[model samples]
Target: MISLTMEKRYEIGLDSYDRLFPNQDTMPKGGFGNLIALPLQKKARSNGNSEFVDGNFNSYEDQWFYLSNLKKVTIEKVEEILSIVEEREKEELNQ
Candidate 1:
């Protein structure tokens, strides 16, 4: 799934990753610029920290079922969203 939040994170990182880590040439080396620990870690899940929740913030009873049903977002859709975001940002800067 190509979530808006996830894509926005990628967009922001593309713009700011190097400035945030001047000493490290991570992006140039094909790195994502940072390491994010895998979600749903056993310990974190047990503590109610890493579980996916619903819009109402209720934990789903069948996380695996929910995950299995998610449809994949296409690359075209992602590029479209990125272009919209870029245009919006430009408008904001001009305001």
Candidate 2:
């Protein structure tokens, strides 16, 4: 969910529906988009480098405590965000 939001915010990659927006031309040229490393691998998790953080960028002392409280991102919310992004892009193009 965070990844989707960040991709839209950065205007990169395809949306949740795998549709590419005009701001990003990631796939039309037959090139795959950039690959990203998964967070919190064994070593990074131990060193706290790839751990998830809060608004202040502080990783929680108990990673499991944070994971346990995570809520699933709803499909409706994803659609809503995509619609909002589409509208914003349209307005930008009109200007």
Candidate 3:
């Protein structure tokens, strides 16, 4: 699954495996573009030390670590989406 991310939105292409799933009769008809958007906002905090309260901490090492974890989650999500497409293809092939 080819994936792309822009801002807070993500999209994955599923055109190559179109033959795997049943046609529109069995499934909703749509293009290969599966998109997901996550609008992020800094949560308000009572502690003045909160990252949101102290904007300078945005680039802290801990923040980078958190972002790294988020990157892993994003990768996993893309893989999960591709697995669905692969499963449909396999089912079609078996039929």
The estimated TM-scores of all candidates read 0.56, 0.53, 0.24
Per-residue lDDT over 1-95 for candidate 1, one digit per residue giving the tens place of the 0 to 100 score: 22344476665444443443343433446553433332445666788877778999998888778877889999999999999999999999999
Ranking by TM-score: 1, 2, 3
Note the residue pairs that clash in candidate 1.
none
Off by over 4 Å in 1: 1-37
In candidate 3, what are the lDDT values of residues 7-90, reduced to their tens digit? 234443355345532332232365422221111223322233333212565434354355455434588889999999999999
**lDDT, model 2, position 24:** 43
TM-score of candidate 3 relative to the true fold: 0.24
Model 3 spans > 4 angstroms off: 1-73
Candidates by lDDT, descending order: 2, 1, 3
Which of candidates 2 and 3 reaches a greater TM-score?
2
Q: List per-prediction Cα lDDT, in the order shown.
A: 0.66, 0.68, 0.44
- Model 2, 23-58: lDDT tens digits are 343444754333233364566678766888999998
Instruction: Single out the weakest 10-residue window by summed lDDT for candidate 2.
Output: 31-40
Alpha carbon lDDT at 13, candidate 2: 36
Q: What lDDT is reached at residue 60 by model 1?
A: 81
Compare the candidates by lDDT and give the number of the best one: 2
Among all candidates shown, the one with the greatest TM-score: 1
